[model samples]
Target: MEIKYIEKVKKAFEMVHTKKPLVHHITNYVTVNDCANITLAIGASPIMADDIREVEAITSISSALVLNIGTLNERTVQAMLAAGEKANKLEIPVVFDPVGAGASELRNRTTEQILEKVQLSVLRGNMSEIRFIAGLEASTKGVDASDADINSGLAAGCSISETIAKKYGCVAAITGETDIVSDGQHTLLLENGTKLLSGITGTGCMCTSLIGSFCGATEDFLVAAAGGILCMGIAGEAAAEKVGKEGSGSLHKAIIDSVSNMNAEIFTKRAKIHEA
Candidate 1:
């Protein structure tokens, strides 16, 4: 990553606190509360309304929209389509999270349906989910990344992230032990997070929410994506240090605290981003 890109990330981080943009989410119920709380922690407002009747209205008023298929259902999927299309028309950035893309027929079909219909500004998911979306062979352990896929490491992640970005014309973010964010032209590898992040549920969903929060503040999708993931990674590291032997329960709360207290100086100094 260049100094300019780091500056951009810093600026986006500041903008989120200053603009306090509203992020509308048509997301999975499983991590919905954490998503909303994380958005707030990052200095953005979150409104989670999946009702098809009101999704358009909610999205129209939001600065950004997040669509997550974590806990998929027929009705919410329609709402996601409605909100996504509305966000496109309004030019509000939309971030899509293909939570369990390769796990089941419903998830796979829903992922395809959203990609076909929505013009996503950013597509974020685990390695396996992203690989599946990129038309590569992927093994998903439910909504989690398969151990084999996780072991594929950075080279494979960079390749798949780039492939998905080019294929979808959106910033692609593949999060794991090492995070890859690509916008076809520019690819960044972020190596900031801890393994403890993976031990907790909703961390991935919260990462998406953080990205959505940043997207609400800026049109630079690549910066927004990087900033969000970097924030989560840094927060995870901070939480891990603070928690010690207190366990994951304490780490979860500490993660939120770390995010809420994140500043530009901390982010710029601690971010582990590199050009790929």
Candidate 2:
């Protein structure tokens, strides 16, 4: 079973580098640069077009679309809807990042609108965001995830993720110290990341882009999302080892370098994924 998952993950990475799938993104301006850089770092081409006029056209030509609501507004919201609708029509996978879903009423309402309108392939968010989207009690500090221990450990997170996945009919991934990915029936518990990852500003946004790249390469949303999360976790640990005492500045650059230099050997050796 481990070998099967390893092979699938390796193939997804190879296809991204070899096929170079084009991923269309309707993301916020705050982490737009990081999103594009991470997409390229993972050997996938990214086209960032949030303009409503061209979003439909851009999504039509891409293999996958990523819709992120980090810095949400009316205009970008419209663009996201247009791009998502087009992607649905083309039968391309769509990865959604519901950033800051519990931060404000505007964000909450907008997220609800997107979920109601678009049929997502994967929904990725932090614990607070996912809980809020699931209509559970949760507190968020801006876009960052607050310290949470609802019913303890990853099991609690898995239950909530499974519920959301079943509701949306898509793969749901809740990322934190121990990332959890679920497809309503099967739940995955992945432990492979560093504390330094929380210091980065756009790591979550970049994660969505990487997941979009993986989804573009394969039809299995579950494996694709797991591969993306695992890649980030392993790359984070590798970058931390290289940075030594340089702190967040060097750690950020090293992460991109790690992703660019990532191979099957490193991933297969370092990945820590389990069926929950």
Clash totals, every prediction: 1, 0
**Highest TM-score against the true fold, candidate:** 1
Candidate 2 is scored at a TM of 0.97
- Candidate 2, residue 92: the lDDT equals 90
RMSD of each: 0.9, 1.2
lDDT over C-alpha atoms for residue 73 of model 2? 85
Candidate 2 residue lDDT tens string, 1-276: 566777888988898888899999988898899889989999999999988899999999999999999888899989998888889999999999999998888888889888999999999999989989888888887898778633345767988999999999999999999899999998888889998999999998888899999999989899889989988999899999999379898998998889989999987899888888
Off by over 4 Å in 1: none
Tell me the TM-score of each prediction against the true structure.
Answer: 0.98, 0.97
Report, for every candidate in turn, its global Cα lDDT versus the true structure.
0.92, 0.90
